[model samples]
Target: MASLFQRRRNKATQVERVRERRHEGFLRYAGFRWAKISASLCLLVIVSYALVDVTPRHNGGSWYGYTLGTIGAGLILWLTALGYRKRKMTSDHWSLKAWTSAHVYLGLSLIVIGTWHTGFQLGWNVHTLAWALMMLVILSGLYGVVVYATLPAALSNNRDEMTQMQMLEAIRAFDRQLHTAAQPLTPEDTAPVLAALDEDPFAGGIGARLSGRYPDCATAAAHRALSASRSSDAEAREKVVGLLSQKQAALGRLRQHLRIRALLEIWLYVHVPLTFALIAALSAHIVSVFFYW
Candidate 1:
């Protein structure tokens, strides 16, 4: 019976070992090789552009320069297509992470090829506009990358697994506690607290939301009022003050959440509008090149 049991255990362990090896092999081929190929291709493009010199003629466009520029522009457009195509592809087939890795490296390759295509010329033309827009888009995308990489961890820590709703609710609960604590205050003492509660938290217009500077925020006003008020009952005043302090802390957390969320969202405003402008500029550039020259 002991020998039988030992034999079963050995077989189970061997099967597990085989599965582990297979998993590692799959990851090696699919994961590492994908990154390796992307890196190698990007290097090849960069090196080729660096080694080749196709300076533009002074009077007219050189056929060689035109060809290089066309190829480079085609690659840029192709890279853009890859971004959209990768979005549509299944994760099992090609992971979004791998696609993004390829996108970043290949996008970097464009800078080398694009500069070579330009021959380092800048002018007030559609060509220049297109190039400027492309740079803007690339820079904004880089901003997004940085924000995603760094802020997400900070956001998670700030949230502590709580949703935004939960955070707001916590703030409101603290406010309720403050309200109860403030009840014992004389009419004169309670006047500011009442005024604070009367003001709207979300009444600020679009400008205030975008600026993130809410001068009329009830929480801030209440803090100031609590600081300035003079009361005879030291112990009661201290208790009320402590509650106000807790409410202020909770309000700070809520505001931090709003600030971070706003920062994350604000970039999209620049990025999306610029992307549309780039598309239009690129179209105009292609049309002007073919029509005039």
Candidate 2:
């Protein structure tokens, strides 16, 4: 309806707007289209379970139960495919963001499908074992999703735009300062200060890092000793104590960095292996059923 020049202007504006649009994260990718689809799928399974009638008491051997089982197995395979899909890079329709969104929602929907497949039956058998493992896998994945969504922002805030190495270097710099400040103090006082200066901030394993609890920390121990003792050289002792406090602050930041990093990473250690184990158990359940039946 517009003139030629106005049409050209509108086209240019549209291009510019598209260029300036914010990048969509995995959760909101495609306007959470996958989430709504997954929700509908779960609702469908639940409603079908309510409506379907099976003879000789409903159980995993029933027709509806088998249908749900097949769907759950296929969904599990697709959900696991995200691990492989993430390794490839592409900006086309099947982007990593799209894959991740599907993995999360569909993985969650498995809770309903897998449970309904059992028809609320439980026992000490391979079938129930598989169900328990599937629950574990989904629970671990949900933990990953929760931490991934919230912890990155907290990590960035804690880092204050600095890289990991930069934070470590800052701690080392404080250690050097502590060493220099302790030079004028007497041996009795300098002993604790030197211990603080030589303390390693990154000396702990995953347990120590995640727990954020280091009772045997040398720097902390030294600080307590220094604060409790009264030395002859008050000036030098005060300087040493101040440096120890500074070193403690640096170590605290370092430990916090480690804590957040561990929280972000620890889930994968549990999530990935449990997933394969779950699939294996599910397979065994299937094989045992057909073999024994």
Per-residue lDDT of model 1, residues 27-100, tens digit only: 24345665476467557655764666555431114554476567667766765665477558565545565566
**Cα TM-score per model:** 0.76, 0.91
lDDT of 2: 0.85
**Candidate number with greatest lDDT:** 2
> Which candidate number would show the highest TM-score if scored against the true structure?
2
Q: Please give me the total number of clashing residue pairs in predicted model 2.
A: 0
Worst 10 residues of 1 by lDDT: 56-65
lDDT of 2 by residue, 71-151 (tens): 998888888888789899997778888888888888889899999899899999989999999999999999999999999
Q: In angstroms, give how far residue 245 of model 2 lies from its true place.
A: 1.9
Q: At residue 50, give the lDDT of candidate 1.
A: 60
